[model samples]
Target: MFISPPFIFEIDLYREVLLFGDGGQSGKVGLWRVWVRFYFCSSGVSIFYVGREFWDERVQVCWEGGGTPLERGILRLASLFYALGLEARKETYRLGLKEASRLPAPVVSVGNITLGGTGKTPMVAWLAEGFRDRGLKVAIVSRGYGRKDEGRTLVVSRGRGPLVSPRQGGDEPLMLAKKLSGVMVVVAARRVEGARLAVEELGAELVLLDDGFQHWALNRDLDLVLVSGEEGLGNGRLFPAGPLREPLRALKRAHFLVVTKRENPSLRRLLASEAPQAEIFEAPMEGEKLWSPLGGELLPLGKLKGAKVGAFAGIADPCSFFALLEGYGAEVVEKVTFPDHHFYRRGDLEVLRGLIPRVDLVVTTEKDWVRLEGLDLGFSPWVLKVVIRPSPRLLDRVLERLGMEV
Candidate 1:
C-alpha cells in the first residue's frame, strides 16, 4: 500500500462537529476562519487538499468553529492538503470535461457543493418522474458515493427492482429508486461509465447526474443547482474553511437555480445573486403526519394541536425538522440534533431515552431512525418521521427544465 493520508483524523473532526455542537454555529464562529482564509490568500495558497473524502469532515469542523485553535494553526499547512483534494477533484473534473466535450448525449446534473441533504434526492425524483410523466425516458447517473458494487457499470437500483437496499446504492439513490416508478438508477465511481451504461444498456435517452455540479469532466445540457434558501451557502468559504465545495463563481455554468427551504422571504436576493438570470425558484420541504413510527395507525399532523414532543435528528438540517414539527402543531418541548448520518451512541441514546417518558413523542428524521433502529427505544418511545413533499409549482418548473411536464 502506498498510503492513505490520515483519513480517520479528519473523520473524527467531522464526527465532533456533527455529534457535538461544533459545526452548528455557521456564521457565528467566523473570527478565526476569516483570519485563516486571509492567511492562505496572502500566502498564495489554496486549502482544498486532504481530498474530498477528508474535506467532507474537515469542512464540518472548520465550518463549525473556525477549526479550533489547533486546526487554525494547521491552516498554515492546509494548502498542501488542499492541493491534494484539488488534484483529485481536478482529475475527476478533467474526466468529466472530456466526457462533456465528446458525447452528444446531453447530461443535466442535480447537485450541490455541500456534503448531503440539500434536497437533491427529491429533485432527481422530480426530474425523472416529471420527464417520464411527460413521456421521456430519463435515467439517473450517480457516483454511488459510499457503496460498492462491480466493475465500472452497476445497476444499483431500478423502479422495477423488487427490493433495493439503500445500503447497496447509498441511501439517496435507493430512496430515489423507491419514489420513482420507471427511472433507472445507476451508481458507479466513474460517472462517465455510468452515463454510457445508462444510454447503451438501459436505453436511456437523457441522463440526469445526481451530485455532479463539480464533476466538470462530464458534459452537461443544463445544470440545475439546488441550495437551501434557509442555509444560503453556509459561511461562504471553501471546504475545511466553510461548506462550499467550490467558490460561488462556479455557478456561472448553471442553467437554472432552485432555493429550497424558503419558508421565509429573506433569501430571494441571495438566491438571485448566486445565480443571476438563472431562473431562481423558491420552495419548502413539505410533509404530512401519518403515524408516529409503527407503520400505519394514521394521524394527520394538522390535528396535533397540543401534543408535547421532544424532537431529535442527525441530519444536515435538523432545524428544518424542528420547524416542520412545530409548524404542524406539535408543541416542541425540546430539540436534540445529532450529526448527519450519526450512529447512535450509548451516552447520547441515554439522553434521548430518559426524555422519552416525559414527552408525548420523540420526533426524528427518517435517516436518523434508520440509524437508531432497536436502541431500546425508551418507554412507549415514539419517533415522528418526515417525508419531503416538493412544492407542486416548483416541481413543475424543475421537471420542465429536465424536458418533462408535471
Candidate 2:
C-alpha cells in the first residue's frame, strides 16, 4: 500500500464532486464520514483532517512513521536549554555584568513575551499617535526586521517624512512612517543606537521601542507588554517546545500588560497573578476598515457579506486574518499564508495570480500591502486597515503614565 504524505482534502461531498481530467484519472470520491483522531506515532508526520466543515476540526494527527514524536522530544529538550540561556542573560543584566543605556528622551517599550502576531506594531503606532497629539515629538524605533541590508542603521522617517523605502527601512517601520506623518521612525539592530539617533539627531522627546521586551540593553521608562488573546502563550511552554520566548515568570518584568485582539477575563486574572505589580488592560485589535490599495477607495465592511474573497497574509498568525475575513461575512475561498514579514516578488505571487479569477476580491493586511507594491497580480488588492481599540480606562492609564491629560 502506498501511503501519501500529510494532505488535507477539503471537500463538500454532498454538493461537490471530485473530477479528474486529462492526465488525471477520473473518479468519484466518496467519504462515508469524517474521522478525527490524534494518532501519536513514534515517528510523527502531521496530517490535518478536513471535512465538510473544515474549520470544525483544526487538530493535526501525528503518524508514527514520520518521526514527529522524536522531533518534538528533541525540541522539548532544546527548550530547556533555551530557558537556561534566557535565565543566564537576565542574570547578567541583573548582576550589572551587562549595562542598559538610558536615552535622553523618555522611552516606552512595547513588546510581547510570545513571538509575533501580538499587535505590537499597532500598539506602538497608537502610543506614538497619542503622544504626538499631546505635542510630544515622538519617534518609533524598530529592529527593521527583514531588511535587505544587515549593515548600518537607516532612518526610516524623520519628522519631515519617510527617508527610505520598505526595502531599506523594513516593512513594519515603513508602515509606521506612512501611517504617522510627523512621528519619526528609526531602524537599527541595536535599539540603543536607534533610540540615541531619534533623541539626539531627530530631537525626539519620546521614543517608542518596537519588539523591545528582550532588548535589555536599552532601558525604558514604561514597559508595555502585549499578549494575544487568540494565541495566548500557546502550549505555555518555552521556545522550541511552545510559543513562549521566556517563562511565564518573566511577566514580572512588565510594568503593564495589554491583552490584544479580544478581552479575556480569565487570562487577565492569570496575568494579574503572574505580574502582580503590573496593571492589566484589554485592547481589542481588529480590522477597522478596508481600502483599495490602488486608488485609496474605502470599501465598506458590511458589503463583504456573501462576497467571494481571496485572502493572503504574511503574518505570524495568518489564521487570525482568515478568521477576521470570515467574521466580516466574506467567503474566503482562496487563502494563502506566507512566512512572517515575507517580501513579495512577482514570481512569489503565482499561486495568488491563479486564484484571482475565482475570487471577487483579494485582500491583505495593511502591513502586507506595503510589501506588495509594484507587483502586478492582475487584480487590485484590497488592504484591511487594523486598529487596536484601547479601552477608555486603558487610554487614561497610559496617558497618566506619560503625564499627559486624559
Candidate 3:
C-alpha cells in the first residue's frame, strides 16, 4: 500500500477532527497515518491565522487580566525590547541631547500614554473650537497617521473646510477640518514644520497638537494627557504585554491629566498619586446627536431608542461605540470592527449590505464616517456625533496656564 502526501489549504479554527482506521489492513493504516498528519498540520496553520487576525485584541485581553499562559509568555518577552527602546528615547530628551524646536505662537498638546483611543481627537476639536470662539486664530498640527505624504507639511484646511482628501491628510485631521470652521489644520511627520507653517504662513495665534503627548520634537506650553476611564492603564505595563505607551512616571511631565468617557474614582486617585503636580480633570465623551451625511439632517440621540442598528467602526476601542449604542437602547444586531484607521474596501461595504435587511439602519462613528464618505455602502449610515464635555473650570485652568484671560 502506498500513501500520497495530502495537499491542504483551508483550515477552520473553530472545528477539530479526529481520524482512526481498523488495524487489520495495511492500506487502511497507511491512509489513517496520512489523515492524522494532515489534521495536525491544518490545526497548526489555523492557530496561526487566529493569532494574526486578533493579535491586538489578544494583547488587550492580557492587559485586562484575560489571556492564555502561552500568549502571556510571548508578550512578556516582546515587552522587554519595547521598554528598552522607550527608555533610550526618554533619556535622550532628559539629558538635553535632543532639543525640541519652538513654534512662534503658543502650543498646547492633547495626547495619551496608552496605545489606543483615549478621546484625544474630540478634546483637540473642543480646544480648537474654544480658542476660535475666544477670538484667537487657531491652527492644529498633527503627525498625520496613515497619510500618503507625511514627509512634507500639507495644509488640510485653511479656516474654511478641508482642502485635501482623508487619504492625503489622514482621517482625524480631515474630520477636524470638516467639523471646525475658521480653524486651520495641518499634517506633517515632523510637527515643528507644520507648527511653523501654521504660525508664519497661516497667521495662527495659537496652535493645537493632535495626539502630541509623545511628540517631543516640538516644545509645547501645556501638555494635556488623556486617559480612558473605561480602560485605565491596563495592568500598568508597557507595550506588547500591556496597553501603556510610556511608564507611569511619564505622567509627571503632563501639565493636566484628563480622564475621558465615564467617571472612575480609582483611576483619578491613581493618577493623583502618580502625578501629584498635574491637575486632573474628567471629560466624558458623550454622544451629542446623530446625523446623516447624505441627508444633512440631525436627529436627537433619544431617537435611538427601540431602533435596530447594525453598527460598524474602524477606530481604536470600537467596543466603546458598540456599548454606546446599547446604552442608548439601540439593539445592535450586527457589530463589525476593522483595524484602527482602516481604509474601507468594496468588500467591507458588502458586509454592511448583507446586514441591511436584518437591521433597521446602519450606525458608525464620525471618524469612521469620514473614511466611509463617497464609498457606496448601499445605504447611508447615521454618524454618531460625539463631543468631549470638560468642566468650565478645566477651560479656565487651560486659559490661565496659557497666560490668556478667560
Candidate 4:
C-alpha cells in the first residue's frame, strides 16, 4: 500500500489496523506490523498519541504560564491560606470578636478588591471635592503606601496646603493633597488613629478613607468599592493566584459600587447576582487636560490632538493610559510601561530620556508625575490629570448617608 504526503497515521495495537492521512484524504494504508516505519515527504508532521492523558494535563498547565509546576502549586496553596485568613478576620469583626474604632466625624471609604489601580485615588479626590463644595471640612486618611517614613502618622496636607513631600506622603496621598487644596490629607498605617487625629487636631467635619475597603479596623459610614472596567476581577481568584484582595462575597459589605473607566455589563451583572442589596454606579474616568509639572499651567487637550507624543506611565494600567492618549487624537509614537506603584529611580529616568527626543511631547499620568519631582528626563513631560465623573444620584445618596442635605 502507498501512503501520501501531509497525512496523519495512527495504529491500534490490539485491533491490528493502520490509519493513514488526515481529514483531507483520510483512509487506511495497510495492516499493522510489529516494527512499522513511517515515510513522509511533507515538510512538517505532527504525530500525537491519544493516550498519555496525565502528561497532556501537565503540559496544559505549563502552557497557561503561571510558573514551574512547583511554584504555581506553592502560590495556589498560599492563596488558599490567604483566603482563609481573610475570612477568619472578617468573621471576628462581624461577630464582634474584634472592635472597630469609630471616629467622631462621619467616614467614607474608597477602595478596590484588586491589588492594582481601579481609579480609587481619583474617586477619593472627586468625593472630597463634592463634600468641600457643600461647605464640609473634608479630611483624607490614607495608608501612605510606599512612603519612606514608616509607623509614624504624617500630615500630607493641613487644609492650608501640603506639609510633606511625595516621598513622605506616598504618591497617591501627595497627589490627593495637591489636587484638593483645602482638604486635609493625613497618612498613617492605622487609619483609625489617623481618622481620630483628623477629627481632633485637623478639626475635620468628615473623613475620606483612601484605599480603606479592606482595612476592617476603621468604622465607616459609607463604603464605596471601585472596580476596573478594563480588568474586572482578574482570573476571579484571590491574591497570589489572582488580583482579588478579598472574596467576591465581600462586595455585599459595600454600600455603593462604582465601575470605573466605563460601564461593564458583565461586572454589573455579576455584582447584581453577588451583591443584590448594593447600589451600582458607573463612573467614567475622564482625562481633563494636560498640565505642566513645573508651573502647573493647564494646557488644552487640543494641544496633543495632532501632536506626536511619547507616553510613559508607572501605573497598573499603562495600556489604558496609552489608549486614553490615542482617544484624544494624540499619535503615540512610543510608550514605556512599568509595574504598578513602581518607584522611579535615577536609572529609570535615563532610559526615558533616550525616548523623549523622538516625539513632540511626553505625557504621563498625574500619579507618575508625583514620583518625578527631582528627576530631569531631558524634557518636560506633560501630566495628564484625570477626573472621575460619577452619577449625580450617587453623590446624593452619599450625602444622604452622611446626614447632610443634598
Candidate 5:
C-alpha cells in the first residue's frame, strides 16, 4: 500500500515519491526518506506562512491597535527607523541644505499632520471662494497625488472650469475645478513649479496650496494645519506605526491650526500646549445637502432621514462618512470602503449593484462623485455635500494676516 505524507508537500515531490514506491521494498525505503525530508520542508513553509500573516496583522494593529506584546514590539522597532528617517529630513531642511523657492504672489497652504483627510479640501475651497468674493484672483496648486502625469505640470482649470479628466488632473484638483468656477487649478509633482505657473502664467493674485504642509520645496506666507477631531493624531506615532505624517513638534511651524469635524475641548487644550503661537480654531464639517451628480439637482439633508441607503466612499476616512450618513438617520444597509482617491473599477460598480436590491438609494461623497462622472453605475448616487463653516473670527484673522478685507 502507498502511504501519503502526514503534512502537505510540493505536488512534484509527491508525484516523484509515488512513482518511486512502485519499485518494491528498496523503493519504499527511499520513498520514506523523501517523505521525511518533504515533511520538514513543508513545516518550514507553514512557519513562513504563519509569520507573514502575523506580520500583516501586526501592521494593521499599528493603525487600529489591539495587538499582542510580540507584535507591538516588532512594529515599535520598525517605527524607530521611520522616526530616524523623518528626523534626518527635518534636519536637512533646518540646516538649509534644501532651500525653498518663493513665489511672487502670496501663498496660503492648507494641510494636515495626519495621513487621512481632515477637511483640508473644504478649507481650501472656503479660502478660495472667500478670496474670490473679495475680488482677488486666486489659483489652487496641488501635488495631484494619483494623477497619471507627474513629470510636467497639468492645468486642470484656467479659471473657467476643468479642462482635463480626473485621470490627468487628479481626483481632488478635478473636483476643485468642477466646484469652484473662475478658479485656476494646476497639478504637478513639484509644487513650486505648479505655484509658479499659477502666479506667473495664470495671472493669479494669490495661490492656495492644497496639502502643502510637508511640501518644503515651496515657501508660503501662511501655513494652516488641519487636525481631525475624530481621529486625533491616531496612535500618536509616526508613519508605518501611526497616522502622524510628522512629529507633534511640527505644529510649531503652523501659522494656524484648524480642528475639523466637531469640537473637542481636550484636543483644543492639547493644541494650545503644542503650538502656543499658532491660532487654533474649530471648523465643523456641516452637511449641506444631497446633490444628484447626474441631474445637477440638490435636495435637503432631511431627505436622508430614515432612508435605506447603500453608502460607499474612496476617501482616507471612510468611517467618518458612514457616521455622517447615520447622523442623518440613514439606515446604511451596506457600507463599502476603498483606498483613498481610488478610481472606480467595473468590479466596484458590480458590488454596488449587488446592494441595489436591498437599498432604497445609494450615497457617496462629493469627492468620490468627481471620479464617477463618466461611468455608468446603472443608478445615480446622491452625493453628500459637506461644507466647512469657519467662524467669522477665524476668517477675519486669516484675511487680516493676508492684508485683505474680510
Candidate 6:
C-alpha cells in the first residue's frame, strides 16, 4: 500500500522534483533555503541540486510507482542523493568545532536540536526580554532565512507594529522585534558579522544566538536547546531518515535544555544521560490570539473554540499549527501548507482564496501573519499567536539568570 512514514517528511518527493529539470524552474531564493536547510545531500565531497517545484508532478510522482524508464531513473538518483545528504549533515556537525572556533563573540545559542519549527522565535524573544529587564543590553543575531535582499544586516525596530515584515527582516527577526521592543534584532547571512553588528553598533552587552545550535560560528556562552514534546526527535535520523540536525550525543554542548510542551521526566532523564552537566527544563506554547493588525481589536482565544477555521501556515511543522488549532477547540475546516518563509506573491493570495473555504474565522501563526501584512489581505484574518509558558523550574532558572524575583 506504500503507507508513508508518520512523522518525518518524505524527502524523496523533494529530491525527485528538485534535481530533474524541465527548463521551466523558477530560480527563487525562497525554494533554495528550503532545500539546503533540510535536504540537499553531499556527493561525498560536494552537494547536489535537487530542487523540484519546476518539474511536472506526473513525471515526479512516476518515481513512486508507475513511470517510464527515464522517470524511474531520475527517482532512483534522487533516492541515492537523499541518503547521501543525511551522511553529509552528520559530516558537517562532526567538523563544526574547527569552523566554530573562528568566531570571537561569546555567543549564547538558543536553539532546538531538531530541524524546522521549534518555538525558537518566542524563546529568543523571552531571552532578549529577560536580559533587557536585568539591565543588560542584548542583541539578537540570526541567519535571516527569508528576507527580500541577502547580505544585509537589518535592525528590527518598532514604528507601526511588532514585526518589520518577513519580506524585510525574515519571520524570526520580525517576531523578535514585535515581542521585545527597544531591543536590537539583527539579521545577516553571516552569523559572525551579525554578532559583531549587534555588539558594536547596537550597544548590546550580551548576544543571543537564534537557531545557532549547529551554527558553531560566533560561538556561544550557555547553550539553550529547545526540544518539542510531540515526536520529540522524530525517527532520530540525521536527515532524510529522521529530523535530528546532529546526533543525540551532541546534547553535551548544551548547558541548559528546555523541552517544549510538557515536562517529560523520562525524556529529561534521557537528555540528562546524554548531557550530564546540563540542567533540563520544560515549557509549552501558551498565548492568546488576541492581537491582529488587520483590525485593531483584541479577541479572546476562548471565543473561537467552536468556530470553523481556514488555517494556513508557512512553517516547518504545519501539522503543529493544525494540532494547536484543534487543541484550542476550533474546527479546522481546511489547511494550506506553504513553504517555510514563503514570500507571498499577489498570485498566492488569489490561490489561497480558493484552497480555504469560507468559515467562521481564519487562523494563522504569528510568523505567517507577519509576512501577509505587505500583501493586501483585505479580509482581516484572525491570528493565533503563541507564547512559551516556561515550566516552574524553567521559569525559576530564567529568573535566576536575570536576577528577578519569581
Top-scoring candidate (TM-score): 3
lDDT comparing candidate 3 with the true structure: 0.79
lDDT of 2 by residue, 278-357 (tens): 99988897777889978879978887899999898887788888998899999998777665677765434544554566
TM-score of each: 0.70, 0.82, 0.85, 0.80, 0.84, 0.74
Tens digits of lDDT, candidate 4, 1-406: 2233543333223212111111011221222223222322222222211222123234335334655878667657877977676676667678998778888789999888876678888888888988898899999998786677645788889876678877888888888887788899998866778889999998999999888887777788999999988888877777656667788998999999888997799998987788888899999887899999887778888888889998989776778899989999999987776544556654455545545556888889989988887776566788998888888788789999777874
Candidate 5: worst-modelled 10 consecutive residues by lDDT: 43-52
- 198 Cα displacement, candidate 1 (Å): 1.8
- In model 2, what is the error at residue 149, expressed in angstroms? 1.6
77-177: candidate 6 lDDT, tens digit per residue: 65455555534544554676324443333467888777667778878877777667666677888777767764576776522234455777887678777
Using lDDT as the yardstick, the better of models 1 and 4 is 4
Query: Model 5 has how many clashing residue pairs?
Result: 0
- Model 1 score (lDDT): 0.60
Cα lDDT tens digits for candidate 3, 1-406: 1222223232223211110111112101111111111211121122110112324457768887889999998888877876776666657667998777887789999989987789999999988999888899999998776666656689999989999999999999999999999999999767788899999999999999887777766888999999999988889887678877778998999999999999999999999999999999999988889999999989998888999998988888898999998899999977877666767765466555556667887899999988889887778889998888999788789989989874
Model 5's TM-score against the true structure: 0.84
lDDT by residue (tens digit), candidate 1, 1-406: 1222211222223312211001113211121111011011111111111212333455467666656777755653553455355455556446663233435456788887554467776677766786777666778987654343423456765558515455556555665665577888887766777888888788887889887776655677778788886677777666555666666776777877777765545555766676686876654667655455554465667655688887777666777778878877889976766555555554465456545555777667655554555567543334554444555665566557656443
Which pairs clash (backbone N, Cα, C closer than 3 Å) in model 3?
none
Best by lDDT: 3
The backbone clash count of each candidate, in order, is 11, 5, 0, 0, 0, 9
User: Candidate 4: deviation at residue 205, Å?
Assistant: 1.3
Q: Which of the two, 1 or 4, has more TM-score?
A: 4
Pairs that clash in candidate 5 = none
Better of 1 and 3 by lDDT: 3
The best-first sequence of candidates by lDDT reads 3, 5, 4, 2, 6, 1
